[model samples]
Target chain A: MASKASTLETEMPTEPTKRLDTFANPNPDRDYQIHIRIPEFTCLCPKTGQPDFAEMQLVYVPDEACIELKSLKLYIWSYRNEGAFHEAVTNRILDDLVAATIPRYMEITARFNVRGGLYTTVVARHGRPPASLERSDA
Target chain B: MLDEAGRRRGILAQAWPAGQSLSPAAWLRHALQLIALIRRRRPSAEIAAIAVDGTSGTTFLCDTTSGRPLTPVMAYNDGRAGIEARALAARGLAEGPASGPYGGPAKLLWLTRHYGAPSGAGIAAQASWLSGALLGHYGLMDEHNALKLGFDGSWTQILRERPFTVRLPHVVPAGTPLGPLCRTLTRRLGLRSAPLVVAGTTDSTAAFLALGSLPVGCGVSSLGSTLVLKIESPHPISVPEFGIYSHRLPKTWLVGGASNSGAAVLAHYFDRPTLARLSATLPLPTSPRLDYYPLLAPGERFPVSDPRLAPRLSPRPADDRLFLQGLLEGLAAIEARGYALLARYGAPRLQRVVTTGGGATNGAWRAIREQALEVPISLAADRPAAFGAARLARAGWLDTR
Candidate 1:
């Protein structure tokens, strides 16, 4: 019992784990949307060094790998104290997701709750459109 | 017979089924059914003028000749136009509160790219399209709906600079008379009198009008999931930096701003039932000691425009009631600060506050707001969008005469 209790206490890390690791996608050949909604997203504002809150949604179609949930949560939590603007943070998240999964398609939508009176929603996407939805001219 | 004093002028409230689908035709069909049902119940009630309030920023592409929608209505919340918004912003064409992906202009641009607009097809927001259909016109749109389409009051040259080409609707003020109701619509509804179909505003604006009579100095505060503040200003105030904008009313401008803090933060901590129970017994703040910025997360816009502002919900007491009281007081303080900010920005002084939304019914919250605002606070006499639409119709008819 003493050993179990000690293991539990030590297992919980005090600092955020920024490492975003991935695993092989079970269905690599097919294109499917992976929708992730993070309602309690928080990061420091670069301008004021104040904490910015946003509700964000990350959608992507995986190619070879899929982002591990535990690591992704840790990676998002890492932004808590980091200073970044709405547009920069949104693009950075997309870049990180792409690097981790090498997704066929991805879109990150971050709606920073109203500040002053304006609600800012930043959407950044990468990769090619699926074969079915691609424009004819493109 | 009942006494003259006992008789109510309005029709008895009847619940109608609300059916909202992705398709524009579905909404139109539902609307037609609602109108027919209302007319059938009250045959003696002469229909004077009709107005519709639609979801702001919802856009659609349609053929003018056939009055048929060419594409599914892109909802106000749709984010499919994010790429287009960024591209437009890059070109400096789309900037401001109306430049986001969910905005009408971005959605219209997205529609044109995805489904090429044929010649004679027009792009319109939901309210514009509905009113146009009723009035037997295809190009009529109100300025309120046109705002998200980047139409600044009377600016057509600005829209001409966009990369894509689609016939933009003719923008008019919200209460302007479009024309008499179409012969086909009148016959379909079996109305004795053909009511004039007027240009309509967005749902929120219609809600403001529904409050009946708001003097220049009075304001209405919507305490929903978010806190929205709107005051009638003598001169139009256009401060987009703080997410504040003015909607044109006949003699006054409706200057308003929205905040991230409200009942949503309260709901995050305690359920509605628990909040109600606690609020009933909640103690008042004696000396304004436990100050909090009750936000579900960090960051707030209105009153203070700090993008990184942190939620100040610390040093919470053990008793749930006390904690709830502190949160209520904090929200009231924010409300007071928002009005003060508006005043600083040259909006008319807030003489009285008319409260609406789910949070408005709380007596405890009202007391807190009264003390914080140092102004008379009263619940809105009526808040239905329908009542506001009726008021618009009456005003439009009066204006035409």
Candidate 2:
């Protein structure tokens, strides 16, 4: 699979031209118990060979639209080996996600395992009451 | 009811059948004592016929009258009795002689031999547990639940005289009214005011109903937190080798297995909208690298069937995003292959795939699947196990409106 990808390196990949997300149903009301775990995640600046890290986990209940998996995977994979700091990466993933799927309540956590003897975990969340799902609790 | 598109769809439900392995003695143990939950709930259901079923081949030790459980019910997925199951098949005491974690009688024997069963409920059945819970009595076990536990599929022999090897549930037909809720339950749990309960079906059975009453060789691919590929067959495929289960569906069974690889992996990365845009940019299934079995993390069940199987992205990934894309594509391929194998064996060829769960709602994944499998897939109206569970509680949720 690696060789094939390399041979086709000249073939421009399907990178997005513009990042815009629209929803059919803007608000929804439902109880949700969403859980996620990322056991394998690594990031580092192209210039620095040192390993940058994030413990990425998200659990949310959905009302109208939830994050799509394939696209989500691609979006996450897009950050790998990029020149982004830990905090920026965490919020960026969350921001892009919120824009894509207008969920009722969202929680995004990035737990970067100990690197350089320093452990960093960032937690971000937004919630909405069942009755007032249109507003965000960011 | 017709939508603007003019299509037919409805909610479905069911659960595992009787003869599903829990010894009747064990079920009775809990059944006799289960009076507590009822007493606590004080269910006052108005009344109709009640349905009592089991968790696929589970029997308990119970006290007869109150249907209180004496034994701990063994789930179909529990594997403590693999040795006993194999021994039973070896002795010709079981049907088909296939030994598995889901195999019923073996687990029962293990419980019977090790613990001597629960008190009060004594030895019991899954249906008995449910019956005791709902009606305050242990009714007979239904057939599908009965069969999975090594009972002869033929309901005529009555299966009572088999041996001290295991206890059996009182097998009954669907819609058969066992009786009414106990007065104590009526007063305590408020079940007395409840409408009639039908002979409830199993979880997977309800899933089958939820999907469609897909005939012989038909099945459902439940892509939830776990990717479960269930296919119906002409012959019961009870091979423990692949995590297959003998379903209560008379001549049919629910075969195939679950893989840790599922939408859970996707959830680890994207939120939703960004996921949609990425969906718009999915590469065609032309990647030469099959290096990705695509488990976002560690371990997988179906397809390769290796628990130690680690997630591998070939040629190593240049970026997290690239690695993630490779993973998603791998999952899509695995899904297609799993369903295709089922089709090759027993299930009908992929004509229309009905998808459910939070992940299934994603158009991007759906499109990728359609292209990967070369078939049509649609999102269901409700993507919830609760919906199906309610239907099972209500018998066939579809036959009404």
Candidate 3:
């Protein structure tokens, strides 16, 4: 009963959750691209605990499933208080998205606003791993 | 914030809230809707012409035949073309302020290759594409949009040796009337007559135009996420080494340079409330000489074009107010040096500076910048880019008609 109840709760999200949810792709064969831009993204700096602002762009080609928009928004908001380097955080976002959707291809481009005096843009990508391999490669 | 004289003239003001991250289609639709709404509200007015100013570097590829986007629009801040830019730089094709990955040309190459060259597709900056969409033409670009695309007096040369053949747009001067709004658009919007669609400039240049005209030597400094200085000059200034270039105006050249130093650094260090608090306690100390070269990384393009330049934010002062003041003073010094470098490179003398962007709101920083620049620093005319575009529409197309 407990396991069933937990599964039911997970299936029907009651609030903004970190767990990314996905729906079956309407066009499984076509290789159309999905682009999402998150402009007001904020995270904490690992070193100073100060805030880092970035406009993150996610473009992907889904395989069998596509990410749900509300869940993706919540997934992004989860990083609000997290402290990570630009490169690491960008790659992690890509990693999470690819894992959630098992996308054929995914790219995360995070343009971090100038910190000291330089603007940093970190682009991370993921391609489809071999089907024989059980895990998606970063 | 119109000037006293402008206020007296009583130019009609309208506000339509806008946002970032709009696709090319959305941008066009919103623009049409906004114009239609304005006309509906004021039935007595007849809009003679329309001019647009899009986000400066935002670019997209379109199929000329259908006037439909072939790929997702690459925004100004989108840096997906880093590898393509590196390749161009390796071939010595990357030059000028727009050589970076986010530049229009780089984005063009990336989109072309990525989409495998859809037939009859041409890449264009946001303003060019939007203007063309309105006028029912395709592959027409303005000089400001074409500059980073390597459009010389006549043609764009993406390659140093040969003309770029990816359906390059025909270049036109700003304020030149392209044509009337297409029949479909006119009928849809319920316009009595097809409005003239004038050639447009980039958003930043349009903002400069919104300054309501300045003297030859006068300049404007935009202290947004980055710092930009533009001054009017008789002759064009092209210093690719310092990331400086000039855009042609009707009479003079708008010589300009940009530095990646400004409010972004402050936002990175402190939140809004904290910054407001720190700023309130300013005019603190001009002494103790905290002459620092603040950078987010080890690179600078203007006033000092060292890619390996290191950021200097050491010797932490215990007082938060002191630290804030030091950063402000450091930025002011950079601004001063930037104007000096421009003058050294044959740009106009620093007659006066009209300040724009978020940092301009800081009065203490303004005082510091005034002391550093040794020139009259005043707030820019507080108006949106739409107002500038409207001014261009009036001056370039409406008045002539």
* DockQ values per model: 0.01, 0.02, 0.01
The superposed Cα distance between candidate 1 and the true structure at residue B340, in angstroms, equals 1.1
Question: What is the docking quality class of candidate 3?
Answer: incorrect
lDDT (0 to 1) per candidate: 0.75, 0.53, 0.75
Candidate 2's docking class is incorrect
lDDT of 2 by residue, B1-401 (tens): 11111111222232325673445544433443443443343343122333444455555455666664556777666778867766765665433312344555566667767766433333354664666556655645555555565544553231233334333456654434455566764565444354344455555455554343332333356676667766666665554334444454534455666677887666666666766676666554454455477566665556555546887656655654465566666777888887776665555565545555667666556666666776435444443433333334444222221
Which of the two, 1 or 2, has more TM-score? 1
TM-score of 3: 0.69
Best-matching candidate per DockQ:
2
> What is the TM-score ranking, best to worst?
3, 1, 2
Best by TM-score: 3
lDDT of 3 by residue, B1-401 (tens): 12211221123444434753546776787788777776766687666788888777787778876678888788888889988888877777556776878676677778877875566877678888889889888878888877766676855355334223357788887877788999999998999999888788888888777655554456789988888888888999988788788888877888888887888888888899999988888877555678877777787878777767888887669988888888888999999998998999998888567777888778778878878987656555344566566666665664365
User: Candidate 2 or 3, higher DockQ?
Assistant: 2
Q: Where is model 3 chain B poorest over a 10-residue stretch in terms of lDDT? A: B1-10
lDDT of 1 by residue, A1-138 (tens): 999999988898654654456677776446677888888889998888988899888887665467888878888898999999899888877765664555667888898988879999998888565664442210
Q: List, in order, the clash count of every candidate structure.
A: 8, 123, 6
> What are the chain A TM-scores for all the models, listed individually?
0.84, 0.69, 0.80
